[model samples]
Target: MTVPTPQAPRHVRAVAVQPHWSARDFTTPDAFRRWMRAQLEMARPHLRPGGVNLVVLTELNGLPLVLRGGGWALRLRTFERVALALFLARLPRALPVLLRERVSPIRALQLADIDANTELYLRTCRELARESGVYLCCGSAPMPRYARQGTVLRRAPGVLTNQTVLLDPQGNLIGVTDKVHLTPDEEAGGVDLTPGDLNELRVFPTPAGDLGVAISLDAFRADVIGSLAAQGCTVLLQPDANGAPWTSQEGLPPDPARVRDQPVAWLESSWQVTAQRQIPYAVNPMVVGNLLDLTFDGQSAITGPAEQAPSLRSYVLTDPRPGFLALAPWVTEGTPDELRQAGLDRAAHSGHPLENEYREDTLHADLTLPPATRPAPPRTPHEDALDALLRGEARAPRPGTWRAALPALPLLALPLLALALLRRRP
Candidate 1:
């Protein structure tokens, strides 16, 4: 009798696709499809046959589709021109919707193109998922509520949302999740978006595990991830697009005594989740490159449960942390000093053709999902300390005495002091 060899159990093999956005890729529906297909193709090689393969993309990856058919204006290389072109082209139909919905012309223009954009976005995702035979998170895009009428998708009367969709290998929609937390920029100005309800957060079950999609900023919120984990979500997908320098400060950072880099603060997100929620697996894909005046950059990473050997592709990090399985290579090639000299921290765009910002890449990791009935990992000391600190702060009494005003006396007297000095000088 011949001895039979036993095969290892199938597990989740995921890829965080780091795509560099370019206006040219979204010039037309065909172009957009090609770009999306290319991204999936890059990740396809890493997937194992007959296993769960998941592809994660960043937030706003599809928002550029709003500029479809503005190929003539792309050469101008300004979002203003593209928006003007699209606005003029859709004015006839958009004007009526703007009047009816009482929305800003900026938003109305996006709405006018919603149906086509949504249809193309859905079709491209479906085709890619089916062709690649992998589960796909189609990233987040600004979209209005829509109804499917047979083969067509029709826009309904609703506010636009930053929404993401997950699809199965068979090209079926598995789940949809909208960003519940909006950045200040997203909530203010013309982009005023509707936030998703926390109560209705969706968790989709898969062979890998129960998966939760938390788009960008939503992933940082404890309540959001906690709700998903409570509902048996074992894996978290955080699609991000930080529209600023990755090395810049995240709005003054968390410490007033010292400075903190934005990307380092961002690392706290996925790492914090695995430590807190006991959701052992998480993927964060970031969209890089520039579009008009806006620039997006970040290092894409796949985080696992515990410490592992870091990949060579990790952003020559200043502070290396555990739990990161893999990280996409940095967009610019240089040492910290060389990069700083190259204006890596500045807003100026480097026109170098060979820069990694113009290229698309993928970071892959093979993760074994915990069993369905697995218990939550024990809390770490760091988490316990944090919890205790939060409790102590909550119980601390707020100062109501005149001593509270002492700290602000100098600030309050600054204007008066300046006025007296100016008067005396005159």
Candidate 2:
């Protein structure tokens, strides 16, 4: 027996947004909702009334909403210090959850305010999707897995995971996917995230196509990307937040022969994987600017398989360039030579004054993917092993398998080396 292939509509207007990520003092939930609404309003020009429109926001863009009630600390220099302060300020409330759950202070801090933060996050997404009449891929956040438990939105009793949510025009959650691969800092540093189950990757049925999501690091994994494509996902949405200088070189370089810029390293996970897998369309929206000390910098872009004809014309980078459907304008907009001559490149990488080399922009492309020319390959045993590993049912992987290769892959390195020692504020 065979299953029918999932089909996409002939045309879709995809919008990828590059949002400036700065800490806002959200003293009230309405303040938080208004800020989110303003970000989506930037894409209002791209939305067509009766057409298939989908807007994608960057990963962890929703994370700062956790700062809802953060007063003067919102103006501080680093998130680690602010988070520590918040945890300590609310310790009396957080201690109970911490002791009950046997989790870290950071986890308990989140759990303490999970109900309010989760509600604001979901409500903002629902309202925007319903009002704009567009499918919305709300940016990722560190929150517990939530489900509707007979009229109440309840969270699962587990450590928080980074999750991306999809909402339809009617304000219904069409799909939800968690980050399967986490950055080093997320695993060991203060974040203390739980890696998501590989088998739970969801594919959403939209007018645009059967959409699949690979949150930031997960986009780089063959097992994750291949699994989604095999399940008939034609459009790949990668919500990302690269908390490092976009111009700086870090991690295992994309090319072993020589060092390349950060964006080049990103290509391996974005268009490179989609092109190789024959996935028709891919959209990556990245957050930029600084949230306290942690910074995010990247040019949000949308592209198709390299073999396919270019459907969108704008390009962000000229060096190590790939065909892009739509690319957002950069904060320091120009070629490497132009930037160097202007001395903006040095300013971008400087450690002195806080850098403002980030932009807020929305990119749109009217894409019509060519019909699939070949069948998507089936899921492999290695992928099955990944699923089992997430389920705690797999034996230790042998030499030269996925486990062996993990250490070398570029995992969207988030450099948090500058975190200051946590000191209590008098």
Structural similarity to truth (TM-score) of each candidate: 0.78, 0.78
TM-score (C-alpha, index-matched) for candidate 1: 0.78
* lDDT of each residue in 1-426, candidate 2, tens digit only: 899877643678889888775577254687777767887898888887688898998887666765778766765556667787677676555655655566666666677776667656777788888888888998888767544333334445546888887778777666567899998767735566789999978566667667889999888888898888877787899999887767665655465567656766777776776557556788899877766666577778888755443554433343434457677766565666564333233233355454555678898877775444444234333233322332334333111223443354344421211122142111
Candidate 2 ranges beyond 4 A from true positions:
1-9, 25-27, 147-154, 253-259, 307-322, 333-354, 369-426
Q: List candidate 1 stretches off by more than 4 Å.
A: 1-10, 148-154, 253-259, 308-317, 332-359, 372-426
Worst 10 contiguous positions by lDDT, candidate 1:
391-400
Pairs in steric clash, model 1 = none
Candidate 2: clashing pairs of residues: 78-293
Q: In each prediction, how many residue pairs overlap at the backbone (N, C-alpha, C within less than 3 A)?
A: 0, 1
- Residue 23 of model 2 has an lDDT of 72
